[model samples]
Target: MLIEAAGLCAGYGDARVLHGVDLSVGEGEIVALLGRNGMGKTTTVKALMGLLPAMAGRIHMGGTDVTALPAHRRARLGLGLVPEGRRVFPTLTVEENLRATAVPGGRWSLPDVYALFPRLAERRSNFGNQLSGGEQQMLAIGRALLTDPRVLILDEATEGLAPVIRREIWATLARLKDEGQAILLADSRLQAILALADRAVILTKGEIAWTGATAALQADAELQRRHLAV
Candidate 1:
């Protein structure tokens, strides 16, 4: 596995959110983390990214135990995140955002990112605050790719975007999958996830309710209703 998290338990101050959660992402695999609101999806991302300290359990990246490492250290170890809300630096230009965390000898370069997201190229000189929501999301993904990460985790990759923009993002993800990138995606769009992800992990009330191939998840309507239905 490229990323392995076992028995992960974490939360905000005095309010635990995750309870012994376990997940793994292999190379060239796309895994979807699904759940309704406040079910610990973002919390899991935070724990995995070291943004929130894990109160229990372990995290291993590229087979190295890194549960105690800081966020920057984990990023250096090849864990990249395109966080929820597309948190790009408002003061930085699109080009600068991509350049800020770029590492030498990486497979993804500015040109490659530009090619993947031509809109970014068109607005390369624009500040992050000046871009539309979809453009900012693209910039976030581009910035993460520039790190040459072993695994990419995207929280709500297509949330709050126009249908056309959402389709574009999904297509981009498909291309990345074809090129053997490992992705961990969290989104509310069940259909899109079923089409894109190899496996699915359903979180319900801070615990993994189910984990299986996408086909199995698709076939189980009752499971979806119990945990995912709004």
Candidate 2:
């Protein structure tokens, strides 16, 4: 497994979120974390990235226990996250934003990112805040990829975007998956994720409701209704 979480727990001050959540993303696999809103999807990613503290359980990136490691330390272990929102550096230009968090001596480089998203290359001088919604998203994904992460995560990757942009983003994701980059994706678009993902894991409330191949997940409508519907 490229990334694994065993019996994980995390929460706000007193409102506990995840309850023994067990999830894993294998190398070169696109694993989608499916759930309705506020179902601890983003929280799980945050905990794994060390943005939030894990009160209990183990977080292993490539079989090393990184539960106690800080976010920067985890990044050094090849973990990259394109957060819930497209949290780009508003003051920095597109190129600068990619320059800031980019892990040097990594597999992917500046030219690679430019080649991946030509639109970003055109807007290289635009500050993050100046980019369009889709452009910002592209920058976010590009920034993460520049880290050359073994496991790259996206939380609500295409939320609140135009249909065209969303489609483009999904297509880009498909390309990334084809390139054998391990991806952990959380989004409201179940159908899209299911089609692209090799495996699907549904989170109900805070527990694992189902875990199976994408085909099985799609065939079982009852599973979706129970764990995913509003």
Candidate 3:
């Protein structure tokens, strides 16, 4: 497994959101986390990223125990997060934003980022705040890719975008997966995600309500009605 977490318990203040959540992402596979809003989806990602302290459990990357590592350390260990929002540096130019957080692993460089998202290359000189939502999102993905992470985690990657932009982002993800990228993506588009994800885990009330192959989950009407339908 490229990433694994078992018995993960995380929360804010005194309120716990995740209850012993367990999941894994295999190398070169896209694992999707599916659920309604407030179902600990983002909380789970935060916990895995070590942003939300894990009250209990283990987070392992490439079979090494990193449960105690800080966020920056984890990043060095090849874990990258795109986060829920496209949290780009508003004050920085596109090139500056990518330069500031570029990793030295020598795996992904500025040329690679520009090649992956040519649209970003066109706006390379534009300040982050001046780009459209889709452009900002492209920059966000580019930023994460520059880290050359072993496991890429994205939360709400396609949220608040036009249909064309969402499709573009999904296509980008597909291309990355084709290039053997290991991704753990959380999104609200079940049909779109299911099409690309090899496996799916559904969270209900902070627990794994259902887990199965992506195709099986999509075929399960009962499962959809119980946990996915809004």
Candidate 4:
């Protein structure tokens, strides 16, 4: 498995958010972490990335125990995160942003990222703040890829974007999957995720409520209504 997170427990100072949540992503597999608002999806991502301390858990990446590693160490160990918001550097231009965190001799190069996202190449000279929401998203993904991570974790992969742009991002994700990228994605769009993910894990109130193949979840509407309906 590219990522193995088990017995994960984390929370803000006084409010506990995750309750021993467990998730895994294998090589070349796309896993969806689905849930309604306040269901601990983002918290899970934070814990995995070491952005927030894991109150209790074990996180293994490429068979290495990373529970104690800092965020940067985790990144060096092949974990890349395109966080909830497309948090690109507002002062840096598109090209600079892509260069800032790039690893030496990485599998992904500037040309490769630009090829995946032509819009980025067109706006390479534009500052991060100058880009539209969709453009920022593209830049974020491109920047992460430049790290040549073993597993990519996308929190709210396509949120607050035009439908056309959302589709474009989904298509990009599909292509990445086709290329043997392991991904853990969190999003509200049911059909889109179901179409892309091999397996789905549903969270309710910070605990895993259901987990199975995507096809099984798609066939059971009641499960969706019970845990995912707004």
TM-score of each: 0.98, 0.97, 0.97, 0.98
Cα lDDT computed for each candidate against the true fold: 0.93, 0.89, 0.89, 0.92
lDDT of candidate 4 over 1-230, digit per residue (tens): 88899999999997889999989999899999999988999999989998888888899987799999999999998989999998999999999999997998999999999999999999999999999999999999999998889999899988998999999999999999999999999866587898899999999888999999999999999998888853
Q: What is the lDDT of candidate 4?
A: 0.92
Writing each residue's lDDT as its tens digit, candidate 2 over 1-230 gives 88899999998889889998899999799998988888889999999999999988999988689999999999889899999888999999999999997888888898899998999999999999999999999999999998889999999999888999999999999999999999999865587787799998888787888888989988887877777752
Winner by lDDT between candidate 3 and candidate 1 = 1
Writing each residue's lDDT as its tens digit, candidate 1 over 19-60 gives 999999998999999999889899999999999999999999
**Model 1 / residue 157 / CA error / Å:** 0.3
Summing lDDT over every window of 10 consecutive residues in candidate 4, give the lowest-scoring window: 186-195
- In the range 140-204, model 3's lDDT, one tens digit per residue, is 98998888889899999889989999999999999999999999988755878977899999998
Q: How close is candidate 4 to the true structure, as a TM-score?
A: 0.98
Candidate 2 — which residues are off by over 4 angstroms? none
Error of 2 at 101 (Å): 1.5
RMSD (CA, Å), candidate 4 to true, equals: 1.0
Better of 3 and 4 by lDDT: 4
Candidate with maximal lDDT: 1
